[model samples]
Target chain A: AQSVAQPEDQVNVAEGNPLTVKCTYSVSGNPYLFWYVQYPNRGLQFLLKYITGDNLVKGSYGFEAEFNKSQTSFHLKKPSALVSDSALYFCAPPSNDYKLSFGAGTTVTVRA
Target chain B: EADIYQTPRYLVIGTGKKITLECSQTMGHDKMYWYQQDPGMELHLIHYSYGVNSTEKGDLSSESTVSRIRTEHFPLTLESARPSHTSQYLCASSEVYSSGGAETQYFGPGTRLLVL
Candidate 1:
C-alpha cells in the first residue's frame, strides 16, 4: 500500500517569491515519489521525482523538491515563482501493485 | 515529447447516453491507465492495461469499461453515463527506467465529460 498527502488545498504566493507546496507519503517498503503539474483543463505533466541518492531533486519549469526521509515528506519548492506557474500540483507514490497513487492535489496560485 | 492523445476534449451528453473516450499513446508504453478526476481535486483510477489484450479494473469501482486492442490505443466505454460520471477522464502511460521503483508516466490532454 502506498499513499500521498498534500494537506493544503490551495497556496498563494507572489511573483518572484519562493513558494512551497508540502507533500508527505507512506508505504510499506521503499517509496518512489513524484511531483506533477497540471494546467487548467490539461493533463498531468511530470515535474520531478525522487528515486534515490540526492534528497533535493530538480524538475521542469524551474521547480524543485526536497525529499526528507526522516520527515517522510517530499515538498515541492520554487526559488522564484511565476504567475504562469499557478496550477494544480500532485504528489504520487507508486503502489505495490504497480499502480501510482496520487494525493488530493494542491492548487498553487501565483500572483504577479 | 510525450505523444499521448485523447479524443473528444469535451463532451456533453444526457443521462443514459453511451459514449466512448479514446486514448492513444505513441511512446510504445506497455502500461496505460485511465483516471477519473474532478478538475484539480481527487483522482480515481477506473481502469488500466498491462499490454495489448490485457485490461483490468482499478481500485475504484467504475461503471465504465476499457479495451486495449492495439498497443497505442486504449478506449473506455460507458453503457449509460450518469450524473456521477460527469467528470474529467485522464489517460496516461508510463515507462519504467528510474530506480527506487520509479516509473514516470506521460499523460494526454484529457476528456472533460458532462452528463445532463
Candidate 2:
C-alpha cells in the first residue's frame, strides 16, 4: 500500500514570496507521485507528476516540485506567489490497484 | 483542459429521494473514477470503472452504486439520498499509456449535492 503524508494543515504566504507545500511518501518500490489543486467548490486540477524522470518536475502555473529519493519527499514549490494561488493542495501516489492514495491536503493562503 | 464533465453542478434534494449523478468523458479514456469530497477536504474514491461494464468499488465504503454502460459514461446512483450523502461528487478519467502505467487523472468541475 502506497501512501502520502502532508505535514502541514495550512500554509500562509505573502504575495510575491515563495511558497512551498511539503509531502512525504511511504512506498516499497519506485515512487510515482502527483500534485493537485482545488479551488472552492470545484474539483481538483492536476498540477504535476513524477514517474521515473528527472528529480525536478515542473508543472502548471509556474509551479514545480523536487523529488528527493533520499528524503522520500516530493514537495511543491513556487518562486513567487500570487493571491490567486490560494487553494487546497493534495499529494497523491497510486496504490496497488492504480487508485490514487491522496494525502489529507494542505490549505494554502497567499495574502495580498 | 481535460475533457471530462459532470452534470447538475448543484442540487438540493429532500431525504429519501433517489438521484443519479452523471459523468462523461470525451477524451476516450479507458478508466473513469468517481470520488466523494467535502469542501476543502481530501477526496475519497467511491467507484471506478476499467471500461464498459467493469465497475469496481473503491477503498471507501459508499452507499452509492455506479454503472458503466458506455466507455464514455459512468453514472453513480443513490437509491435513497440522506444527509450523510450530501457532498461534492467528482468525476475523473485517465488513459493507460504505452508503458502500461496510468497517471495524471483529469477531473471534472464536480457536482455539489445537498440532501435536506
Best by lDDT: 2
Off by over 4 Å in 1: B97-100
TM-score, structure 2 vs. true: 0.97
Expressed as tens digits, the lDDT of each residue in B32-104 for candidate 1 is: 9999998668778889898999999998899999999999999999999999999999999986564535789
Tell me the deviation in Å of residue A74 in model 1. 1.1
lDDT of 1 by residue, A37-103 (tens): 9988789999999888899999998999999989999999999999999999999888757788876
What's the chain B TM-score of candidate 2? 0.96
TM-score of chain A of each: 0.95, 0.97
DockQ of each: 0.72, 0.67
Looking at model 2, what is the TM-score of chain A?
A: 0.97
Error of 2 at B46 (Å): 0.6
